[model samples]
Target: MSSSVPPSIPRQPAAGSKKQSAETATGVTKRVAPGGKHALTETEKRGYALGVELGSDVARQQMEVDPKFLMQGMADGFSGATLLMTVEDINGILAEIQ
Candidate 1:
């Protein structure tokens, strides 16, 4: 009896590498918008500023309360409203918070 096994094929270059090379050769690039990822409109900027200002006021209100309250408040605020925001944007904001 004769065995019947097909020859294996060699692997090609990675698709990602090919894409990167193509992009480089074509002078194609990507970058954050002037403001950042998910650039906020003027209205969004006003909302963010108001939210921060209100948070500051609330922080003072919690001077005698547990610190956890403030943390929970921040978590709630971030979770509740995040229009026109991306993970990168949120991370950058959190980094500034720290």
Candidate 2:
């Protein structure tokens, strides 16, 4: 299935590639607001910043968090796209983590 999420926020990196730092990975800071078109509004920028903070905290705690999968899940949730995993699968994973 196709995603509405922009390519800048990739779902995954190419195999064998080193993971980038959060700033470079997200490309949020480097993004230019182009004539207000495709530009994130103040609220959207704030939300993304907050999400990054929260995700960072989660990563610190979990240590094994895959950012690509996290981004894909968030994008799916926000875009109302069909999730990659079922509710039961999610619950099972959460149960395992717990």
Candidate 3:
């Protein structure tokens, strides 16, 4: 499937935005800074939590995953940005691991 990147990622809010809302998993809402910089939305928060949990699992399994690449892949996937690697590349990596 094809997808396009969003104007801004969760970590970086769009410029000139008045306010950004941050809703936690517990449903608590808070306003970000005046410029709404470095604020994450509810979806972003959940995605981050899930990412952390999965990362922990990978660590527990003693998997040697590069944090930089893993984060980049997650960002690309979430923002619909062009993937750094092709499907075949990913398959080949997985095959090697297997």
Candidate 4:
């Protein structure tokens, strides 16, 4: 069995690009250690819901709107959470059911 993945998962940029997409002090490494491995410690764990479809450009376009960003804001703050996990899990379960 195999797992499908996102078309592209953006790579965590090079060390020089530390501040890029990082929610932290401006250009400062948030880690206490020299390597700066992790930015922040998890304060909580949370659950999520997701919907995915491979058809229809219109549907995809609508999903890109920012109105939903607020609804999804810090709700995705949990340690191990992502929008695609739910999609893949549901697909795997359905495949097994069939």
Q: Return the top candidate by lDDT.
A: 3
TM-score of each: 0.28, 0.52, 0.49, 0.17
Ranking by lDDT: 3, 2, 1, 4
Mind sharing the TM-score for model 3? Answer: 0.49
Top of the candidates by TM-score: 2
Q: Tens digits of per-residue lDDT for model 2 on 1-98?
A: 46644444534544654543335343333332324335788999889768767665675566687666777888887888888999899999989877
Q: Give the TM-score of candidate 2.
A: 0.52
lDDT (10s digit) by residue, model 4, range 1-98: 12222243434656665442332222322222334555533432112112212212224344443333433532453323465447667589559644
How far in Å is the alpha carbon of 91 misplaced in model 3?
2.0
| Candidate 1 error regions (>4 Å) | 1-35, 63-98
**Segments in model 2 whose C-alpha atoms lie over 4 Å from true places:** 1-40
Instruction: Estimate, for each residue in 2-94, the C-alpha lDDT of model 3 and write its tens digit.
Output: 343234334554577566677644454545557434578999988867865666566666799877677677778767887778989989997
Candidate 3 displacement at residue 7 in angstroms: 21
Least accurate stretch of 10 residues (summed lDDT) in model 3?
A: 1-10
